[model samples]
Target: MICRSCNQEHNNNFCPNCGEKRDVEKITLTSMMSYAFASVTNMDKGFLLNLKMLLLKPQRITSEYLNGKRKGILNPISFLILSVTLYLVVLELFKIPKKPSDISKLPSGTLETLGNMSYKAGQFIRTYLKFFWILAIIPLGLAQKLIFRKYNFTEHLAISSFIIGQATLVGIISYLILRWPLIFDPVIYIMITWMVYRVFRTNNKLDSLLLAFVVLFLFILQLILITFLIGLSQV
Candidate 1:
């Protein structure tokens, strides 16, 4: 018999080439539901397993993930997506008001004019949050390459992505608990420092601390520049 799908010879009850059952002509809704549920269960298991590994042994998880052992673990991109989604959901639920607008409504030569610092800071944070994942990858990838010295660039990116994802999750949770000022100030700073220390444990402890400080300083400087531009535009 010839398999209609692949135009190949078949001897079984189904098409050997395409593996389509000869008796089954159409997909049923039942089959679709079954597949959908199965997929959801598998994905949930994978994400939970990855989350456990990330919390328990982050360094080992990163190394193993980069080494191609990703069958039961969450992929870096998926991890980031899940985390950021939850973060935004929480932010909306709380109805947290964002920072003030850049341009003040005060008339010229007003003695009680408000400085643009607060509005500029808000703009800076908003921009950073939008592309935070991409920006985070730079320091993270550089850290992996510089510290490990053996992993390939792709592997470093993978590790960096995972580390950043975990840190992002932490930041989101902190924001939900403490609101904006705390989120932008001590909370993020402490979390980034802790993440750096956790990822580079094999290196000298002091060096990891120093690197974390450097990274935080650079991030703050970038924020300042973004805010300044936003403020100037409003003027």
Candidate 2:
């Protein structure tokens, strides 16, 4: 059979040339739902296991993946895609009430103008949530790479992907599923710090914890600055 991906002929279940599936079935509602179900619940493909591992051992999962021990585990970016996809789906299904934008709480004058800009920036980010996630990934990865010099930028990127992906899931679940308010949202920061500390704890526990907080702070500050600039550009 000819491989549709690379136009190479193959006779295997997966394309020997490009690895496209041999049995590319026609798309249908039944097929779509079936594929989604299997992909989400299927243990063989490492979906559920990846989810469990992300919750229980987030650092080990990424560390092992970077250390070339990847086998049954899902790729970090793929996990991020899955997490983002699910977050969007859940968001659409459940319209959690948006907190009313309080312009009066602004500091007046220039800061107030900046506040409005930030609000617009936030609106833009919310509309392009999936795309903005990529923005967050780079900064977080840079922060991680800076503090943990042993791991290179790309390795930290893998770590950031895993960290943000898991944070997205946990954050959405806490807000939408568990009915937690936005004020309690600092849990996500704590979660990120925990993942970073755990990944670097082999050197020195106290130092690792301090550096993890630093990483988290730097990531947040960078994210805010970039996002604010994005907001500023709209004006």
Candidate 3:
């Protein structure tokens, strides 16, 4: 049979050159719906597999992905995006009110200016929270690079993405428990620390302790940077 994808001759169910299916059926509504449903099912399976591997064997999953065993598992960036999107949807579905930080200590003039500016400027920032998330990934990657000097930057990035995705899921659960804006921050930090330690398991207790401290330091640094950005925007 002639392969349509690469114009190469093949006699299999799929094109060996490009892996496109050879069973070219007529276009119909039923076919389209079936194809869409199949795609969704495959994606759902991939995501579930990724989640299970991340929870059960994070190091193995990262190593496998870095080593080019890529098929049948969700990619890190896609996973992160999906997780955050789902989290945002959950927040909206529950009508979770935004809990602003306490600014009572600031001067009345500053408060007034902030209240005025925040409504306009804050909307832009809130709408692009994903950008802030990507920005934080850089520093988080750097922290991982410092701790695991042998790994390349891209490897650190992939792992960090997966970690952030998992942390988002954990944050949703944490929110349900306390329903406080900042309450999930500590939980996320702990989740990150545990995830990283699982990925880079060490024998020495001191190494584990240091990783715990490093995760806390990174979380604190992220918090400070975000606070500074928000404060600057208020000005």
Q: Which of the numbered candidates is closest to the native, going by highest TM-score?
A: 3
Better structure of 1 and 2 per lDDT: 2
lDDT of 3 by residue, 60-137 (tens): 888888899987778888888877777777767766666685545556786766665555445545677666665556
Ranking according to TM-score, highest score first: 3, 2, 1
Each model's TM-score?
0.64, 0.78, 0.80
Q: Rank the candidates by lDDT, best first.
A: 2, 3, 1
Which residue pairs show collisions in model 1? Answer: none
Best by lDDT: 2
Q: Give per-residue CA lDDT, model 1, range 1-235, as digits (tens).
A: 7777787787889887788666654679999998656644563456556666777778777777777766677787777666666666666688676556536564445322336544555556555554654455665566557655767777767766676667666777677677754236467567666765676665588876776666556655655555566566654
Q: Provide backbone clash counts, one per model.
A: 0, 0, 0
Stretches of candidate 3 off by over 4 Å are 25-45, 98-105, 108-125, 182-184
